[model samples]
Target: MSSTPVRPATSRPGAARAAGWVAPLCWVAVLLDGFDLVVVGTVIPTLTQPEEFALTGTGATAVITIGLVGMMVGALTIGTLTDLVGRRKALIGAVAAFSLLTLLCAFAPNALVFGILRFLAGLGLGGCLPTAIAMVNEFTRSGRSGRATTTIMTGYHVGAVATAALAIVVIPSLGWRWMFVIGAAPALVLVPLMLARLPESASYLLAAGRRAEAEDVARRHGLELESPPDRAAARSGGAGAGGAAATVRSLFTDGHARNTLAIGVTSFMGLLLVYGLNNWLPTIMREAGYELGRSLAFLLVLNVGAVVGLLVAGAFADRVGSRLAGMIWFASGAVFLALLSVRLPTAGLYLMCFLTGCFVFSAQVLVYAFTSANNPPHVRATALGWSAGAGRIGAIVGPVITGALVTAGIAFPWGFYVFAVVGALGAVALSVTRAVRPAG
Candidate 1:
């Protein structure tokens, strides 16, 4: 219906054309996800205004933490569901779930109601990124995976930047509730498009022994199917039960367990920094003496830097391994985050915010990259799902701690320093994971 044919394989005559559309479509979905993810933060400053929402510090922080906790559950539960079901179905379901809940958030009667709805919305939101990342990685050529992922992920920053702009335009005119209302709008637009246009992951189909379906997808997309290799053939040589068991077992066999734990820890720290800063940056900066306008502007600048960082890291990760690049990028993030604590001129603060955004936003992305690289094709989704799921614990902790500190009268500089420590811990966790290799 959309004029784009579905080419499922990596190398077909029409593969490029089909991929051209697929990548952008997936990116758009991710953009919507990012938009909803950061929209609350964009609206937070307005929400905290006594005349507006009259939200207390503790109440505000509790709402954010509750949403993140919901996201944590969503990430773990939905991620595994993606492996069991198909990526396409799982993704659509997630979008629908989050969208409905976002609509609920727009009309919440109080902070308590808002917090609960946001939490439900967050579960859907949490499931989206890892599933999209896994789907994109599987769809692209091995060598091009990093670029494809990063390019797509740029949509996330773009969405964040857009939310900041929208906040400036919409919040003043329509009120903060309109922000959540806008967040729900995308689900309406995207869900129908996804159901009609998005295709099942070829890898998923093949793994499920749905060859006819796989072939149909490839034919529609004009892609070539790789001949079943010796490894695949041997694995399937036995009954389907053996192959399924072998796939699960291989995830832990051959030294993958240590790598799994390392990736989990790294993801934990990376998300801690990401969610901590993203959720609290405006509040932190406002307490640091910035006006509401200036604080929101800081968020825009940070996301601009995030766009740059994702592009740079994606290009670099392809050349050096994702592991090394992630380590370097995260280490750089730590340096910049630490630097943000120092009182600087207004211009200097903006510059530091930009630099911090560059490294901090992409650091979490690198965790996804590392998860993809460490696991074999069969268990890749599971690995990413569990890693991201585990990481949500840190995500939950970051905002709670930061908000508590703010409530306790901790200085902005010290709050940032605490985030910097988390970044450093991420660097160490990722570095330890460097030796992990995919199971053969």
Candidate 2:
């Protein structure tokens, strides 16, 4: 099919305005992802209480792990599907799957059923981020992908902040299931809007040997299509084992292996810090003797810092490169996380929590930004998929460890220390990768 039609690209301002829908639509999808993922953490306290879900520490951790397992699978599998089915279809399918699954979560009869629903939801959750990143990168003007990634990622923090705020009000009154109900509501609004407004990736079209479609897309977005569509490569790079296998092989060929391995390691460390904190920050804060409200509010404050970090880090990444910005953010994150070990006044604690979120969350995103910026255009989608999938090891482990710590009653001081160490490791990982890029 020809690319989604737009006004002729002759007028610069007109073409720019016409293409404005890309970032915001992707932002909405990312926002929903942030909301869905953060909701589990926001309601963890309620779920574990004696009179409610009565979930044990181990069971709670298992729930999180199960979900992450699905996420890992989704990232690895559906990411390949995007290359085959087109970005819009894959993205919309992912959002639809997760949204519907999230709705079912409210009807889950017990923890096991709820966990299953969450697991399925994780499939959608896991697939959305990288696909969104790839699409956003493709949609932006040349040399601006890093900035676009960071800006679109701000939707994630905004969703986190909004959902956490909602939790403060809803958990006590309507109970936790209602939170899932609200989380599912986005599909109704977003899917139609996405279908109406979201354009398929021109890069995907070009790569797939759809020159006419690619050229149409390029014209619509004021982009130039380079090289006729590579149909042979596209067919050979089809999805499933045949395609994914070759793409994986390509990564290891032509000196890409070193960089690939380095990013994998960095992604693992960075995600450990991200998923760990996202899953346990409230619980950790609460166990530190903060009031429950304050603990939940810390989630809000932390995500507020995340939004700020996105803005600051995005600009810096655009100028100095995502690798250096990631290193700086990770180092700063380590220091702030370590400081959480000390009990402080309310103001001091809030400030630290905000700053920790600012650095820790953005640090991982910068890793993603770096991955998006550095890889070969042909293999970029696959590389991102694999990097994110590899990182899910940390996503799976982080919550489990934090859960065990919380169960052991050491989540406050010790948890922060552990996170501090992970943050440092992430920084080092990113630093190591910087020296291992493709030899020109």
Candidate 3:
């Protein structure tokens, strides 16, 4: 195994050029994740219309919850799979699985089948995020994992934003099935690009005992290949099981258990905020008296804020440390969300939605970045996947709670207040986890 560390790109122009593919390709991969996050929300209004699919509120909520359950299952399993197989293979396979399943969703004849298809697709798409984040962190310049992590995360919201915008057009004109068709369409290009152009993580290759491949990747990508102490048995409790199982077990020992638990809770809260709003913001707004177009517009605005937040949060995390940055982001999100409980003018509402987005969504990404920065390479994806898997619990709950609120016609201020509290709790959870030194 080898240790591949990246130095600043500016000093090595050639290295910068060589390593350029890591961020962009990973960004595209995460973009697909963003699409999945909001696609159901985007089409739900039409699905529930009596003239169309006519799904009941419970049915809609079930669709959203079931998909999240699949994501939870996927996140928990994929990390282990990535450690055993390889990041490249895990990511590429995940994308392929999701794309095919998502395409099938467009052809579902009933709500039950549609929800089932979504759950299956969620199994694949859920893996995309942690895998992509872990892979990007491995290739980034030292001390810049935050930037790389957040930069790629912007793609998630970009996909969300694009899906919402598409909903404004596609849902009304072409019908809701087209949204799934369009969502699946990207895999055709993304899968081939990933196979042809995406290199496996040098850190992953090294950890897997493929030194030659790791070295080759590092050199090709202008990474400086060094070595860690012991290079094999040094970090994460001597690689107990020597695969995904070992990695997961190591997190429970070696003083890692506390941080893992805290991060999981924080991720849960962060994702609760993210999924709750993404899945229900349009309906929530519409229930608040806004028309459908304006309601969907708010969803787009929220994600646009998310893109901005990711840009700001990453650089901020790089400077202040991911933990502090995450805590601050969660707290700030809480404030913004609390303020949203009060009625505002149209412009004020958009600004608040944008501001709420900035903090709420990026707070979760910061948790991923924090996980990446603190964990040993061999267990990084597993840790991230664990955090995300726990958060999937929150994701499932968020939409269900909000959907219930919407169904009862009480989602507006109450929903925002609920989110605000969740954000505050997330901050408290993050505050409990301090950094640790890699095992020697």
Candidate 4:
């Protein structure tokens, strides 16, 4: 039924061509996840208009928090499932499921229905980040894990930035609902491409004892199989990854328990900053007396900084190690976040937002890079999943806390103070952990 010939290991160009697509495909999936991060924030201004959803700040928080709860569950479950089932299937299913649910969000009858759709859509969206991050890391050359993880994550902020820009044009003309429609449209193409072309991780295949399949995948992609020295342990750990419960247990039993707790706390604070700011910054700025369009621009500026931060942090982490980089970045984020409380001039505010964006988002991502560096292949997804899942709880709390502040009319400067403290906590968490070689 197919005319494609199997390329041999010597086919360098074919291998390069084959190996390169993985990052782009996974990037777009992450971009969609990025879109989710900002699309709600983009629309909140419009939704609060009396003619629109008439959403109070409290209602907005409820919808956003419920969605995050779904992501928490999805991250915990899908991250483990990806390890057990195979990255390819789990990713495809996640993209398709999220796309379909996002499309349904366009027609939600009221805030209640809209919130429900968001929760359902979040299940798939939550899985996308950990899955994409883990997939890209496995394919990367070693020592480049920081850059690889950060590079792929640019898609996330790219999506957020693009959504902010699109909202400016689309929301004024088409209405708030069109954002969801546009967001889901990419998945139609992304899913089919992933289905037809995306290769399974060779690591997963080998872990499952499908050596022939693993070797073929490795050979075609111009990758070497695990050498005998390290292969035994990778395989042994992977073998136990067969069941989700057992795989989770492996995380605690190895020297990983401390790293797990540390990563969990760091991820919690990291995501709390990420979701808190991205989802609520526009509202926060608006309450501080910025007009609607200017408030939206703050969202764009923040994520543009995120893109720059990812590029810089990735390279920086590679040089200094992820843990050390994370400490500096989180501490820096706290400084900038705390500085936002000062009533700066317009240009100064924009510059601070840009700088804040740079460190704040990447600070969380560095935690992910650290996680990838510390865990072995078999339990990597589970570790990433649980880490991200734990972060989702923070994501929920960030929005709810800010929304309550907004409701009380005290969100602006006080919100920044709370966020600054969270950033400090993250730095503290990472400071406690000494680096370890990845588990077998």
Candidate 5:
């Protein structure tokens, strides 16, 4: 019997440009998604005023939680679908769905109706990040994945920063509804570009037995084609498994259970800190004795720190291990978060806010780096999707907790301290997980 010829795992040079463009494009899409997701939080303070929207505290929290619930469902359902359909298609569909729903939010008659629209919008928003990350992961070369993913994620922060700034100017004159209107506009621009320029994942096509299409994509991007390998071998090479069942099974069988749980937990805590702060920072600052205008300015400053952190993390993680770098970052974040509870002088508070921003947000991206590195190709999408899906649960919880704290008359410093504790817990979880490296 003749053996099938084996292809060497050599680097393909032609994919560099394609890979470069793919990361930035995916980044922009996710950035817009992040902007819309957080804009509601930035506007909540205005919405809650009796003279403005007049929403009660608990009612407002309910609205935020409803959107999160929708996002959780969206992440799980759309994540699975990304495996069945292609990432590009799923992403385009998700963006369009959310875009229209956001427009609906602009016209919502009451708080309940607005909440429902936001939840539905959350469904589409939930799918965008994981799908975009998966696309970027597939396009990047080995050893460069962390940098590529983080670089792309910087767009997310940039979007948030832009939204906060825009909200300051626009919300004052145009009203909160205009924010949704503006949010919806990006989908119109992005959808067509994605359809025209976004290529399907080469690995997904190969797994689905569409070698011709896969090869065409690879050739267009300057990759060479090899015969598709068996399922197990393809998975081992990091060609992601396409089906839901197969992807889940891969996580448990190959010394991955521990790693999976670790990623889930770390992601949980990271997101808890992220959503808790992002959702309540402005409100919390207002309660902490800052004026409304200064509170919104703090939001911009926080995101500016986020952008700086994301830019630096990849280089540091590449030098050290991602796990180690993530642990240190989370630890620093915890420290800064706790310190925010104390009333620093004005300049000191701003400095601390910048420092906190630098580490807190990127710590979550490091979780993505860990997920991408731990799983092989076939199960990579599934692993990332599940991680993100789990993290969304924490995201849902963070805002609710902050809302409750505010309702209870807890000082903003105390609320910040609570967030700091979550960050500390995350640092601990990630530290333990780092000890056991998965076989790639």
Candidate 6:
């Protein structure tokens, strides 16, 4: 039995308090997702040591690609499932599943075993991200959804930074396996908190006709039920369909077809830049004459920029619209990425890395913010899932392409060129989506 009374939403303070609780829970979930997401990259340097995984560049890329393949499948499938089931259930299930699998990865006997475990862990990893993003957007105030989404996503960079810091201290002495051990720790801590405290999406509850529960949840959390005016049409043609196929079909049938395609292409390009650089940046720098420690430090600096970028981009997006913000941010990211092709002094390199991180990581996130802002509640989860799923294709390709280049010993200036091009393409895709809106 519980003793906490439901606070009346009579004042803005009450609403802010309720939001405080909900937002942090969502933040922790995404933080764990981010931590696990970057763990592979953090450990790749150690994994290549002769005493460690002894993986070739191609083999390492295969592991990353395989994991992303699983993530793509999970993002497409489980994202729709989040819409059908409740967001609460999907989020908890994903965190728990990934945590357990990642713990098992510590004991993998060979490269084959490690790659398989990473792939399995990735299913949960991919599933949790879009769900977390959707949850934050749904719970926050309408106009603030973009900021809420980006704010909650800061947890991802925090998690990535934490992983990188730990790697700096732990990987040298504790071995790369310790990183997996640490990555799995969030599950033990976060799962119980989520199950006991996290509230279900009021929008989902209302759509499913659980009026009493939805009302109670809304009251307790100081959130209004997001029953869009177009509920009838959304119910008939979009998310209300019990089948994933029907839901997916609805994305293209409505005026959403063009927007959907644009989001997909944009996500593909955005994620390619994100994953490609994050996964290969350290190694690329190391190959280009930087020491291993400094290379790892660059990853940390990059994500620090990501944290700043999320706050800046989110605030700007709320004022100017995500479409315009994304265009500007992606363009900025392109210029910084292209600048990396020139080898500068250590201070200059660090500045560029930080600036690149500021724009590059949050560029894709603004695309997500745009998707959430544009879609109605009924199809929001599915739309975000598909967009992220499309991005996962870029995720799959990014590492593989970078890995191939690394194997061929041509990953330096060429990798930066490819990433810069991808960033430009993302900006272009977002520009095209400005003319299309979802059909009601």
Candidate 1 lDDT by residue in tens digits, 18-54: 6455676678778876786677766777778877667
Q: Residue 299, candidate 4: how far off, in angstroms?
A: 1.7
Q: Which of the numbered candidates is closest to the native, going by highest lDDT? A: 4
Mark the regions of model 4 whose C-alpha exceeds 4 Å error after superposition: 1-11, 44-56, 228-242, 283-294
Checking candidate 5 for backbone clashes, the offending pairs are 238-377, 239-377, 239-378, 240-377, 240-378, 241-378
Q: Return the top candidate by TM-score.
A: 3
Give lDDT: candidate 1, residue 167.
85
Model 5 earns a TM-score of: 0.88
The residue-by-residue lDDT of candidate 6 on 218-296, one tens digit each, is: 7777765433333443353234446567667767875778889999999999888888887788778877886644455
Candidate lDDT values, in order = 0.75, 0.79, 0.82, 0.83, 0.76, 0.80
Off by over 4 Å in 2: 1-11, 44-53, 229-236, 282-294, 407-412, 434-440
By lDDT, the better pick of 3 and 5 is: 3
lDDT of 6 at 78: 80
Q: What is the lDDT of candidate 3?
A: 0.82
> Per-residue lDDT tens digits of candidate 5, residues 1-440?
01011111336555545545667668877887668657887678778987666888777778878888887778777876776677888888988999899899989878889989989998988888878887887776556667877888888888888887788889889898899899889877788878777888776666555668877787677555455635553433232343466557666766777777888888888888888888777678778886643465777788889888987998787777678889989999999988888877878888998999999999999888877766654555667777888888999888778878988989477888888888888888887664333322
Structural similarity to truth (TM-score) of each candidate: 0.87, 0.89, 0.91, 0.91, 0.88, 0.89
Residues 36-139 of candidate 3: C-alpha lDDT, one tens digit per residue = 87788777878898876799977887887888899999999887677667788999999999989999999998888999999999999889989999888887
Angstrom error at residue 28, model 3: 1.1
Ranking by lDDT: 4, 3, 6, 2, 5, 1
Q: Candidate 6 clashing pairs?
A: none
lDDT of 4 at 409: 91
Clashing pairs in 2: none
